[model samples]
Target chain A: MSLAELIEQRRFVGREFLVWLWFESELFEGRFSLDALGACELWLEGQITLVQEKEQSRLKGAAPSSAPEAHEALRQGKLPSQARVRVTRGELEYAFLFNADAFALAGVKIPSVVKDAADEQFYERMYLIEELETLFTALYGEFLALRLSAAWETGVAPFVRAWVRGEPVDVAAYQKLRGKLAPVRGAARSRTTPPPAQAPERAARVVA
Target chain B: MGALKGSISFSKFYVRGELPDGFRDRFAERIQLRAFRPLTVEEDAEQRAGWCSIENPLDCELDHGKIFFNSYLNLGLRTDRWQVPSALFKAHFAEAEREHLAKRGREKLGRREKEELRAVVSRKLRAQLMPVMKVVDLSWNLEAGVVRFWNQSPRAHEGLAELFEDTFELDLVPESPYTAARELGLTSEQLAAFEVLKPTVFHAESTLGGAR
Candidate 1:
């Protein structure tokens, strides 16, 4: 379904939409205009674009230096020799661009079922835009939850055991593991100070 | 035109109860956010003076709490690092397709025409071969093809190859060939060392200043 249609259908009903309208009304103060709304649309679209670009550039073989190599490889009619496999739980699909050192998780195009539901609820109330903002936030949160859960099931448990035991981990095998473990090592090493004490609530959210 | 497109496909599995040790603690530690000084009032006033005025400075706070994660894994196995929501995924695709069309000077088409074109393209692509088995992951290579699917799942490998052969009426190699090529591209032993990394971390900081 189209975005406009999605917005129309999902226009917040009841308190959800009303709360959004109230908040937006307070923020825009009745000064909202179609142009402003259009601008917001563009801004949101732009964010998706940025995220997509970041993902594409991040792929394994898509590095700056390697782009030339990739081009030459393509020009020489040499198909890419190595392929990376990305596995996740659930019925989600991802598109990726790859380079030797990195692979970007480019963009996500959801299935029609999800798209239709979202479009159906896109804009039912005058405060539809505000409702959408909330929806996007919630959707992102859900995405993170899915990722964390999947990682725990697939990679985290294995990695933690290896790390704690000081076992000689096959770095290659670990790389094949999922979640944010690889980067965390880099981040942790760069830090001289210990991580700040986390609040109980915030900590719970992360673990949950 | 540079917008990327694809879908997020995942499956759910249950682990028998008996919690893993330190799992909770490590997860909590990863999700925690570091503190940062709030933007001073003077800075805020300069930025939103005309656009928005804040009546209560102390009452204003911004919540930026989006967590992005990634992983590194072996060549053939699947790793669960992150899940992209269906809603956001479609939105991104629609937005990207629109941008791509606009870049190609196709933006002037009527709404119906645009829809027709999109349908035609999607149909043509889908028909090219293969029933989608398990979509291991989707990605866009800005340099080569706009989209590529890795068929590592046994079901996908078996299904897609036959689908492609029947649908497109072309002789297509098994999905493993494509995967093998992908593996070859990562000769640095890098493909085998799949690492999960966090892309972005969002936080909600309680600020001392208001917009105005």
Candidate 2:
């Protein structure tokens, strides 16, 4: 199905489900957004197929290939596959395939700044670990160690790679991270004081 | 009150007589005209004989202020507004003319340079004029050649249009965009790529170990 259609169909889906799917599948919860999901769905529609495994019931079919082979074949041993799932009010598309162990790592979460909104299709990415930590710390400040672990599991690794390479992440996660970090940023701003003015000579010396 | 803290450019004026005595004096004293380097004149026997020499020059000599005033007046006429007085108008006109002359001195450039120059001029004019008009809210369009002067009061627009036209020689048309994009240091290609791959959703079809 087209991304728009899929998103529309799954528009009622929650962000948590999408987050869980992304985390469990790729473990690379880079930037997350509905648009990213939609694009993935569109891309997957052009690439994947679903296959079901069924055993040959009759002896006429011939002897089983081997004990382990029969068992492996029954489980569809390492089949190449792809699927597109829509989530969050049908606003995002998640495309995935049953291949590669790259998605086994912990999820990464990065803080995002909404640099431009006119082109809702693309966003600016900044990956300052401190910024991410500050945001999470502010959002779940009360949760202590549990929240930190959750953040590590869901946000650290993916966020680092995405931020270092300056790649986009899931939009929803980006927004959530920003929301989490807002209070911390505000507190930092409030706590800081402007430097006092110095004598002209001192200023000149500093400049020199 | 504190000299407005920025540059001011002026354009057209329809004075009944010599600018009202008090207005002229206040403008002359309060408005400081930034001076330009004097132009070098070549001495020739024929030129000297015709009274074009240093002692007795032409009847009407060009100063930075005069050039600024003329350009500012021309800009006012084009935009159908007048916001500059003789003093402020002359100062801005001179600056613009000098810049224009300097630009003409360049030898080679491409389309991008030309576009950049135009954008720079547009931005400079806007920056200088916006402050003088006391315009708190305004929008500028470089491509369309328009500047929308907006305020809570309608009467302010009348005087501003005239003052603006008198200062800059460009027409100040009025229209505003709902929003504008702020640059974030990303290349156009990167922005395009980010837009395309930004939305991807992943799903797990089956368990990793196939326990379920």
* Off by more than 4 A, model 2: A1-208, B1-150, B171-212
- Candidate 1, which segments miss by more than 4 Å at Cα? A1-96, A112-208, B1-33, B41-212
lDDT of 1 by residue, A108-157 (tens): 23222221221122111102212232222232222222233435434433
The Cα error of candidate 1 at residue A103, in Å, is 2.7
Name the 10 consecutive residues with the lowest summed lDDT in model 1 chain A. A41-50
What C-alpha lDDT does candidate 1 achieve relative to the native structure?
0.26
Cα lDDT of model 2 by residue, B1-212, tens digit: 00011121111112222333454234322222211112212211111011011111221232323222110110111111223355754565556556765778854545776565544544444445522212222222222222323232335455455444443333332211000000112235432332332222122222121111
Q: What is candidate 2's CAPRI-style docking category based on DockQ?
A: incorrect
Candidate 2 CA-lDDT value: 0.26
- Per-residue accuracy of model 1 over B1-212 as CA lDDT, tens digit each: 11111232221111122323653333223223211123222221111110000111221121211111111000111111122344754665576568767788875666786676555444443344322211132221111212223433446444433433332233332212112222223323332221222221111121211221
What TM-score against the true fold does each predicted structure earn? 0.17, 0.16
Candidate 2 chain B: 10-residue stretch with minimal lDDT: B175-184
Scoring model 2 with DockQ, what do you get?
A: 0.02
